[model samples]
Structures are given as structure tokens and as C-alpha cells.
Target: MGIFDKIKEKLSHEFIDIIEWLDYTDDTICHRFERYQNEIKNNAKLIVREGQTAVFINEGQLADVFKPGTYTLSTQNLPILTTLKGWKYGFDSPFKAEVYFVNTHLFTDEKWGTKNPITLNDERFGLVEIRAFGSYAFKINDAGKFIVDIVGTDNNFTNFEINEHLKSLIATRFTDTVGEAKLPIELYAANTTELSETCKEVMQPEFNSVGISLEKFFIENVSMPEDLKKEIFEYSRLDKIDLDKLTKFKTAKAIEAAATNEGGTAGAGMGMGMGFVLAQQMGGMMAPQMGGQQQAPMQQVNTMPPPMPQAIQYFYSANGQQAGPVAFEQLKALFANRTVNKDSLIWKQGMTNWSPLLEVEELKAFLGGNTPPPLPGS
Candidate 1:
């Protein structure tokens, strides 16, 4: 080939070849050339340092020369500059991107500073304090598209703008999830953990749209109205009150039963005493009629004028002195006339011996008017 043609071919082959020759030196030149070629082939990578902000380009403008290392704007030719000034940096690998977070909002409160804003409070229905809010982190998966479709040649995009948009999106999704829950105020107030978990559950799908994965969401505190709190306390104590009332009822019933039994015993004793007194009076009144019948019989049956005109009788028997037949009428008369105290009669077992009973008054009251007559000659 002609020198001119060869020179032209070398220069015109591929931009990569020209760059390779330009960087070549010695044995290391080949290694350097290979490394550069590989870097170009895979598209140049950059590094976003820790605690630094970065701009992404979608125009593939950085596909050739970008290197994977922390960089700052030391030279004017630096391809991009972030709006955050020194805050901007880049990462070559998704792993390196993880070292720095993009600080995008996974969710935002449209009701930002309103009375009832979209916060832990909104989900839990109480005064909740948010310590650390939810945010997202992402890396440019497609460097070419990141450069071309996103920030283009200029690195002038504001993280605030991206964060705000993301915040709005998160807020919108969060609102929808919360609205659909329809949780009761009381239950929501009590279960802050559950509320946070529920928010995370609902936000997962929406967060995916912005190339972020939600790490976690948590509720710190919950507050409710004073009246509501008091009501809850009262309700919890209700069972104890009911138990106390039941105990009192049982005690009252036992007392009432004891009183009733005691009264009945007293009344029964009084009635017995009154019955005895009435029996004694009736017996005394009938005594005289019985005496009259006995006297008449004696008047009829006594052959000899009443032996001694007596309330007495003589005894004559073949073996010994025996009481002559006491006129039945006289005996009957004695008993009926109350001449004899019926209550005083007592009989012995073997001999029909008669004796006076002790406690005669008690006996007479217990026996009615028809009590048997005392034995003769006693």
C-alpha cells in the first residue's frame, strides 16, 4: 500500500485504533492498549464518591473516555458538572453506586405542612414523629441511555427537582394505599408498627417505577385525642366492674336467706308456748261437769249412805282390806269437777303405784280438758 494510503487507513480505521496508537509506548503499551480497548468496548465508567452528588447523561457522550474513579472539576474539560457543584460524582459499577445514594424521594407529602400531612401521623391517625423518612437510591444501568435520555451533555440537573418529583409520586401512591385501607381510628392509633408495615407493603410497587427498592419504613409514635384515650381506659376496666357487681349480688342473697331462717325459728318457738297455755285453760273449764256426773252416780249406787259422805272410799276384800267399789259416778265426778289434779297423777310400772308428778303446771297445760282422772285415795 502507498505510504499515504497506509497513513489514512491507520487514522481512519476506527476511533478506538487511533486512540490506542496515541497511548502506546513499550511492552506496557500493548497492555495499556488492551485495557483502553476493553474500557471503550464496555463503555467508560465513572465513580460517584461517598457523600457526593452526581449527574447522569443519556446522550452516550461519555461512552468513550469516562474512567471509574472519584473525580472532581480540576479541569475545564471534565465532561459533566452536577448542579450541586462539589456534590456531584459518578460510579462505574452498580456496586460502586451503592456507596453513594442519589437522595431521591420515594414518597412525599403533598399535604406537606398541613394540619394532617402525609406522614406517620396520617397513617396512624395520631401525633407521630418521623425520625428518618423514606428515600431511594439508583445507579445508571445503561450508561448510554443515562447520558442521552437524562442529563445530556450538560451536568446541570438539580437533585431537588428529581427528588421532588419522586416525592410527589410516592405521596400519591401512599395516599391511595392509605385511603384504601379504611382502618378505624382507634385501631390505627394503637398499631403504629402495623401501620408502617402496611405503608411499606403498599408502596413497594409504586417505588419500583422510579428504579428504587424500599429498604424499610417505620412508625415512631402515635397520639390520639384525650377523650378517646380516656374512653379506651374505661372500656378496658369494664370487666373488673362487672365482676365486682356479681360478687356483691351473691353476698346480698346469702344475707337475706340467713335472716329469713332465723326469723322462722323464733316464730315456731312462740307458737308452741301459746298452744300449751290454751290446752291448760280448756282442761280446767271441763273439770266441773265431769265432777257432777261422778256425784250423781255415787248417789244412786251407794247402798249405805255415802260411806263417809266422803270424797273417800273404804276397802274390804277377802284376803285383806281392799277399797270397796268406788262409785264409777263419784270417780267420774272427781275428775270432771276438777277435784283432782289430773296433771298430778303418776303410775309406776309393775305395781300400779300412784304418785304425784313434779312440774304439775307444765303437765296440765300440755294435757287437754279430756285428761284422765287422778287415782282414788291418792
Candidate 2:
């Protein structure tokens, strides 16, 4: 109650005797401990509660960092700050320096996503564009580095500022990782967890460079354009369809459609045509096995009669040896080239022995027109 005692009490209040941060907001990443004149008394109480770190900066230079403990700030405890301040010996007076309390707790559920589509080359789909989004968790690993690199002199730093930078880093690394993986585009959605792990591994060093520890990264979804999705779905559907069954189904449908037609002659003709096509398809499907298994035929049934037993191949004498079992057309070519003349002996499958080409019945019609009278013989 004396005037001197009251003055001492007032002076103590003026100089900050306790330095701490009781964060009430969820987003704050770092909060500067505020005092009346930014001064802390010698041997002041500094409380860095669990999930927090206390850092002191001297003249804009990082000096001391205390992790998750109670400390009385002095030259011994604040050696870096004391050295930076050139305090060779401890002083009793209040000191002027910046103290920042960094939140080191795991910040969970931070969202990251591709701001733009990432273009990649897919083996099956060719060039494709896709996008992905996910959540992650991070914590401040090095309070000193974080304060110096990110917080700087900002009295209030929040998750929003850090997230903006991190998201860009993640996006860049994600694009690179995905482009290099060379995985199928469809697989991205199927293997999000795997992809997420891969991306986290690739991006960890980048996060470490900024004093943030990436604890968890998750890929919630990978998406592509609607047209691309539809195309992929259609391709899958076609691959799974049975072509023979599909042909039978269509032929039945065609028959039903032809039967339902109302036009007179045109409708009859349509029905007949459909019936003919149906017969051919059914014949191919039910054909007797050539060996034991009936291999599926890919070609349509020939409407023309079986091609005249392959036009009767023949062998002819050429270069003093039998040359070929060539068809009639090839024989004509041989004669035109003078490699086979009327004296050239020829034989076919049914012939008992070789005969002169001129004597063959099949060649007379061709030779009568093409051959000239022999020069007058002696």
C-alpha cells in the first residue's frame, strides 16, 4: 500500500515478465508474443506448451528456439539471442527482441488439388488430361527455419498462407510424378492410395526444404473429361462382347424387322434378302467341324458357287524341267512369254502321261486366236 511498492508493481506490469501464446484460433500457424513495447524482462518466464515452439529473433535474425517446455529466458537459455545482441555478460535490464510461438501440432485435413488439368501420355488412350484432389497433414518440423523462411516479421501467420505455397508445390510434383509413372489413365482412379504414396515420397524433400513435415497425403479422387470416360467405357464394353453371339443376335433382329415390314413387293424382297443372310449366318455357325473343333469363322459366306475346282492346275516342261502346276491364266502368261510353246509338254492330275501343249483341249481356244502359222518348213 506504500507509494514505492505501488510504483514497483506498475513497473513490473510495464515490462513483460511472462512470454507465452494461448492460441484460440484453429488456422493460426505462428503467433508473435505481443508485449506493450516488444520488450521482455531478464529471466522472464517463457512457456512453450505441447505442440508449440518458442523462437526468438534478434534484429531480424533467428536466434533461439525452445520446443515444448517451460523456460526462464536468460543469457544462458537464450544463448543465440545473447550472442547476436553482443551481450558478453548477462544484463538485468529488459531486452528488446521478437519472440514468435510456432504451432507445431499436426495440421490435418488440409486440402490440395490440381488448379488445372494435367496433361499426360497414356499408352492406350494416347494424350489424356486429368485432374485430382486430396487432403494432407503437415506440422512444423524446424521452428527456427519456419520463422526465418516463412513467418518472417509477420506477427500473424496462418495456415492459409502456407497452404497456398504448399499446394503449388504439391501440384507441380504431382504432375511430374504422374507423367513419369506412365501408368494407364484408368489405373489412376483404381490406385489412388498407391499414387498418393508415390507422390508423398516425391514431395517430401520439397516439404523438408520449407521446414514442414508431410505426415499424411491422400488422393480422394482422380477424374477425367466426360467424353474420355465414355470412350473408355465403350472400349471396355466392346472388348467383353462375344462377336459370334452378337452376329446371331443381330441377324435375328433383322429377321424380325423384315417380317414386320408393311410394304408390298419391297417388303417381300427385304424378307427374302434377310432370310438368305440368316441362312448363311446359321450355316456358318452350325457348320460341321473340319477336324474336331469348329473354329469361329470371321468371313461372310460366299454367295457365288465354289470357284470351279480351282481352274485345273497344270504342270509344263520349261528349261528342260517341269516348271509349274500353274492355273490356266498362268499357262497363258507362260505361252505369251514363249517360255512354253505348243511343243512344251504339259500334264494335269488326270492325265496318264505328258502331252504337247498344243494337243491339250483346254488350250486350243486360246491358241487358235493367239498363235501364228509356223514358217514354211523344209
Candidate 3:
């Protein structure tokens, strides 16, 4: 044996005896062993525990990758390294190489979200501004690609380095996936299940480029601007109101009121009150369906009947003061309250002068063909 060999032999051996990465950290995604300036023995024992991948690199070139289990480092176990190492003797001699332990188990609770409002041109709600945030889980599926692309020379590759990159990918793909659905901003919050799955598919291509496979993805909450959220909240709460229950409660109270009066007058008053209530309900149901509109009637007078426009505005005068410039539906409410009449002095923007509501002709049906009984004798 040579002097160096004699020294190594005297010490029983002079090469890396065992290679492992037992000190794992929560923030670490990939960790490379420093090897303490020691060379790996040809037959070194490599222990890759579960949820870990062992990567061999030499001269900045990637070599063999090993999964869980103990590996005896040799030409047979590392063909790529053997080729790179140019092992003429079947990798029987000690060689220097880098070993990186990649975290292959699912890395979870990684969050992604839009930092700013994402604006989308929706089909139904027009332009909408929304924000969405969520979490995802992933794992390194290709240790070779991961080591060469991500962990190259990075002794402590961590999640912080790639967190923003993943979030950017999510934002870019998020806009496309959500915009494609064409859902209104109001409806986005309710579509989490579909959005999560669709977003995963949308982001899968870029994720693979980074050597990751999505294990589990989530779209926790999608929300709109604060004003829009409040409006939606109020609408949701109001939608739960039961009109039938209110009607029953009102009827019961009226019956109670009638019972307190004497001389059977309460009975007659109750009958009239019930009739009034029934009439109000009927008028409400038919106001729009019966085409009891004021503005359109005059327009069709000069031409054949026209299609109802999507919306209409009106102006009216009641109690000797002007009270409108309101929606067609709002003006119709005045009729239900016995306030609109033959001489109610209602006018629309196109009219030349304020005229009796009856002259509008479109609102004539609201009068029910009566003149208010001539006001009990003029």
C-alpha cells in the first residue's frame, strides 16, 4: 500500500462511511448534506427515510435518485453516477458526490391568494371586482428535476424562496379559470368546489415544471368588495323572509281588532278591511303583468303597439306637490294606495304638460272605470 493508502488502511478506512439527512426542518423543502469535506466511500450506506428522496450530483451534473429505503452506494445502485464517475472498476473505489435529501411527502397548508382585486368582465353582472384566497398541498414527484432545477447548490432550499412564485402562478391561472366560468361576482363565493378543482387543473402545467404534483388544492373563500358583500348579505337575509307568515299574522291581528268593537259594526268593518287587503294583494300581483304602465301608453298612441322597454321612469303630483321621477313600478305603487286618479297630474319626461293621470291612457286601468263617486256630491 502507498503512504496515503497505508495511512487510510492504518485508520481502517478514509472515506464517507454513512450518508444521511436526519436534521429536518419545517421550512426546508430540500436539504443537501455538507459531507464535512469527506468523500463518499464506494460502498457507503445511504439511508433515505420515508418521505425523503436522495439525489446524487457530481461536478454540478445530476446523477441517480433514490427513494425510501437503505441503499448501498455502488455502480449497480447508481448507474448514472457510475457513468459520470467513469468507474473503470465497477465503482469499487471511493468517489466524491453531493447528496441532497428532498422532502417528498406532501407539503401542506401552502397558501395562495390575490393580493389585489381581480377585475373580470362578466356576462351578466358586467365588470366585477373580486378577491379570492386559498391553500394548497403538494409534493416533489420528480426528484431529479427538483434537484437540478430548484435545489441546485442550494444547501437549504426552503419554501419562502418559492412561495411567491407559486402564488404568482396561482394568480395568473386564477384569472383565466374564474373568468372562463363567466359567473357573476355575487355567485363566486358559492362556487368553491368547482373553482378549486378547476383551478388545480389550470395550475397543474406550471406546477409540473417546478417538479411538483398537487396533492390537494383548496379555494377557501372568494369574496367581493366590502360594499358588494354588505348588499349581498342584506339581500340574503331578506330573501329568507316569509311573506305568507306575515300575511297570516296580519290577518290574525285584524280579527282581534274587530272582536273588540260592539253592535256588529266590527263585523262589517272587518269584512271591508279584508276586502281592501285582498284588493291590495291582487293589484300588487297584476301591476306589471297587466301593462298598467303610464309612459308607454302615450307612445303607442302615435304608432302601433311597441314592445315593453326593459325599464320605465315616471313623474307624478299628489297632495298639490310633485312626488316623482320614479320607476314605473314605484309610480304603480301610488295607484295601489288609492292615491292615483283621473286628475292626479302625472307626467313623463316626453309629455308637453302635466295632465290628469287618466289622460295618460296607459294608467286608465288603475282607475277601474270609476270617477271616485264624484267626491260625495262635487
Per-model TM-score, in order, reads 0.30, 0.65, 0.62
**Residue pairs with backbone atoms closer than 3 Å in model 2 (clashes):** none
Candidate 2 least-lDDT 10 residues: 243-252
Off by over 4 Å in 1: 1-163, 243-378
How well does model 2 score by local distance difference test? Answer: 0.82
Put down candidate 1 lDDT per residue, 1-378, tens digits, no spaces. Answer: 899999887544332211111212211101112221121211323344332233332223231223333433222323342222232454322110111112222232211111244443433335432221343433333333333444433323444434555556555665565556666545655666776678777766654544445556554444555675676576566667654333333333333443445567654543443343234334545878786774434545546553323222211121222222222222232333343344334332232444443333323433363666799998
lDDT per residue for candidate 3 within 300-372, as digits (tens), equals 4465678545344567776776664544434444565455666788888688998888788777766676654
Candidate 1 vs candidate 2: the TM-score winner is: 2
Q: Over the full model, what C-alpha lDDT does candidate 1 score relative to the true structure?
A: 0.39
lDDT-wise, the better of 1 and 2 is 2
- By lDDT, highest first, what's the ranking? 2, 3, 1
Number of clashing pairs per prediction, in order: 28, 0, 0
Q: Which portions of model 2 miss their true places by more than 4 Å?
A: 1-10, 237-239, 243-378
Reference-based lDDT, each prediction: 0.39, 0.82, 0.75
Point out the higher-scoring one by lDDT: 2 or 3.
2
